[model samples]
Target: MAFCPICNGFEEIKIACSSCGNALMDNGRIMDYYDDYSPYMPIDQMKMEDGYPADYENRECPHLLKCAVCGMNVVRLIKE
Candidate 1:
């Protein structure tokens, strides 16, 4: 099975906000924000319906990162 380092807490992403240059906070997987029940579903299953057709096939985990200073939101794809 494919696994995500960030999601599993095995690693961390350090990215600067393009607008404010501040640190971006990881807000977990983007799939979780789809609905209330999305967080409770299986990871691979959710990836299939996460709007990105290649996420499941590529085993990539999409994470939502936000900048508190500029309120900038970004979607980063992490290879699993």
Candidate 2:
């Protein structure tokens, strides 16, 4: 549901790697990964009330975009 600023086209809310020009996968919020460490927590415990975090639109909790093709990665500060 995100658009590319450079191409003005709808993209998968992720950016391609600059070095490899390969599309990146949207791995979601950074906090979600940290929440996975709890031994007693449910697997789905990190679900958000909204589709995204409250501060996500304000460029907090950046999205982690990873490129499987070339191992290049980037952190994008997204705004809804």
Candidate 3:
């Protein structure tokens, strides 16, 4: 996990991308997984060389990060 270059606060924030404080509008609303309203493309397990979703069911998901320096929320492209 990456840290904020400035305050280093919210290091374990839900968003995978770094963020700035300003982007945070309210509490408990940082654009979580269920927020993704886009179409879902199923992942093919057979083609995966390695067993995907390692401990997925139990693993905690990553969330967005707010930048302490610029105070803007950033987005991250997640990989499976």
Leading candidate by TM-score: 1
Candidate 1 error regions (>4 Å):
none
lDDT of 2 by residue, 12-80 (tens): 574668888888877765445564463244323332432445543443335568898988766665554
Quick one: how many clashes does candidate 2 have? 0
lDDT of 2 at 46: 33
TM-score of 2: 0.51
RMSD of each: 0.7, 8.1, 10.9
Clash count, one per candidate: 0, 0, 13
**lDDT string, candidate 1, 1-80, tens digits:** 77999999999999999998999999999999999999999998898888888998888999999999989999999999
- The lDDT per prediction is 0.94, 0.54, 0.32
- What are the models' TM-scores? 0.95, 0.51, 0.24
Rank candidates, TM-score, best first. 1, 2, 3
Q: Is candidate 2 or candidate 3 better by TM-score?
A: 2
Residue 64 in candidate 1, Cα distance off native in Å: 0.3
Over the full model, what C-alpha lDDT does candidate 1 score relative to the true structure? 0.94
Tens digit of lDDT per residue, candidate 3, span 1-80? 32222123334334322343244322221222333531132222211322334323333222344555566654332322
Candidate 1: RMSD to truth: 0.7
The true-versus-predicted C-alpha distance at residue 67 of model 3, in Å, is 0.6
